[model samples]
Target: MGFGHANAGYRRLFESDGLTFGAGFPLTGANRSSPDVDAEIRLAKHAESVGFDALWARDVPTYWPRFGDAGQTFDTWPWLTHVAANTDDVALGTSSVVLPLRHPIHVAKSAATVDRLSEGRLVLGVASGDRDPEYSAFGVDPDSRDEAFRHRFEAIRACWREEYPERESEWGSLEGDLDVVPKPTTETLPLLPTGNARQSREWIADNGDGWLFYHLPESTLESYIADWRELAGAKPFVIAVRVAFADDPTAEPEHLHLGYRAGVEWFREYFARLEGYGLDHVIVGLEDDDAERALSTFADDIVGEF
Candidate 1:
């Protein structure tokens, strides 16, 4: 009974006026396939010219080659359907999508045909995958990823609300009007539920619309996201970090393998303890030498102080 923001092109990138910026899947032109799709459409038009509010993508399959993170190694649905039909206002996610190795009705009809061809602009993240050799080559059983992420998140929310609901247990069953077509131009489809992939935190606060943490220690990640926002009653919580900036704001942390090799005033006090842990959104992850000069020095010192 919640999810609003009826797609005025995804409410100009997640409503409520401000503070949203994003990143996580940035690698084009150089990913060498000789395809270059305009380097992922100029990395989604350079994250809408640095005002970025969203652009994540990652559903990597095999390449554990000693756990050397091969994210954005391409092929995530024609690279997110060509970055949601060549971005215009940003906001297009998927820092997940491992729902028991495919078939949540083809991940809800290819993310509702890329959210009705980006008019609504997708944001269905879901997860429960970890590449144990690509789920043993799709025999899909790296210990039943928490019962296949609760039967693929209840069959991708009954294939986006029943015109054919009745997806029985163990993930299978869809009779009648079988209507799982492009039903997400609005009426809801912003899924987000990355970690806690094993469910229960009151079932990811009764089916997420937010909550994807990683990289801790901001006072234990603010009492674990304030008990997941008091059990996430009003939804909206995302946190991800793996930054590496150093042009000397007094350079001093150093640890990098995933995150930390700081400076820029300790990465702006680690994004002000990630906005004192309420963190509506923060998904940085630029790596190794000049990821566009550590994302243009984190967009000129931490995206203009939030």
Candidate 2:
């Protein structure tokens, strides 16, 4: 099997024709504050039990007071390890790991460790650093991240797929003498670059195993999928949305941040429309105050309906 195709997690989550759903982490309503880790874990297990295809984790290395979102309030690597150990059979994903902020060696090693320990359940979403404050904090030049992203991406793939591969780049030099330990269960870990990562569409098509993007309107999504087909040809496309489900099954759509507030009936229709546009997967951010109830409702009504 090829690089991305060999990974069991990628296959289970993205290889199918119809759309699938994943529950985003920090499974609580708290955004600007630290989440209750015990409750979040319970919800993650419950999410898998109720048939969520995957569980998504976000990488927010630092808490920026200005940004106002702490992003699950956990380091991604250890957090994923915890989730992987506690859950069974659900794909574990980094909604994105900011590549330009960390060394590719560390990223590659940690990803491989998680993939191996999970028995092939890790899907790595790579991105250029988005928070402006984070770049300077990490001592990276924000303006040069386009170059850094490409270099780090290449380095990570090399570390995973090659045995002591001879390579030299800004990140580091591998002299073909010592191999990176705990290589992935597959030839290479599946990489889904998030939102182009400051690269051209052609670069994205050529490099990424798949593409992870933000939610766009239906008409725009259709056009984007059409263009993607023309460039990448069946490589999976994934998106995330912040959804708030109402009690009434027939409630109308109300716009929110990056998603909508709607009834289960409206969600069924909206997701079907996304499937028609050739979307492979969606990671849903459940925004309801009652997290468990919202997840249960979505699973029983919206997920199965599609």
Candidate 3:
């Protein structure tokens, strides 16, 4: 029932109980696709010092200009390995790599590489993908993604858990003659299936080390948490929230796309309620431009709640 939380990476962000807060890529300063790499690394270092439980990177394979988000502008594995090289004690995560678009063998190899290099500080988030343009570009059929996602998931796990484990999939197969080198620091990697990945809720509850859900309204989130508790038992549930800090500490919620535009005190109360509802961790995407100050304030106020 504990799944992949046995590893240090999952443990860094989640405890046996309570909630923790994390921040995603691009920090605050050079927060764009063409951000300064040096500065971003520095920001990562500083972010850990200021107390973010995890640092996440998105897995956007191509730039869908119409979609309007380039996602960190770096490949997930190398960038995460680079960040792992720089930071100490902070968990490194992939917000959700697109499983339908890539080969599972490569993903397994790359994920294991980062896990080994970081000494077990990687939490992999995987998804079936939602981008319309990406399907054709990657030569994958949109309707078939559901199956692809499932197969890729199985393939990746097989590569990690079995040495040259013979497994067949739509992506490809291992015949037990060839093996993916360098297993994860632990026996297996912690894989959190983000969104549905086009699988049933039960499949996610059964397979994922955790569930990476999107931000929802308070009432809706509460209902989902109740359902998750009934289905998943003690497995962790994580959500990504978009936040914009307001000047007033007590300002009321001005709901943005995914999160609220409010003061830290208000956010503190909001997250406290989330934790109470059985949410284990939050990955915040700061909408405000002041990254350092916002991080510091969030660490002091909202993160301090757990």
Candidate 2 matches the true fold with a TM-score of 0.97
* TM of each candidate vs. truth: 0.33, 0.97, 0.96
List model 3 lDDT by residue over 190-292, tens digit each.
Answer: 8899987888889989988889999999899999889988888888899999989899988888988888899877888889899899899899988766677
- How far residue 306's Cα lies from its native spot in candidate 3, in Å, is 1.7
Q: Against the unseen true structure, what C-alpha lDDT does each candidate score?
A: 0.70, 0.89, 0.86
The number of clashing residue pairs in model 3 is 0
Runs in model 2 deviating more than 4 A are 1-4
TM-score quality measure for candidate 1 = 0.33
lDDT of 1 by residue, 184-222 (tens): 776667777787787787887887767776677668778
Model 1 regions more than 4 Å off:
1-21, 24-88, 97-120, 123-126, 129-142, 146-169, 183-241, 244-253, 264-297, 301-306
For model 2, how does the per-residue alpha-carbon lDDT over 83-194 read when each residue is reduced to its tens digit? 9999989999998999999998899999999999999999988999679988889889999999999999999999988889777877778899988878999889889999
Alpha carbon lDDT at 136, candidate 1: 74
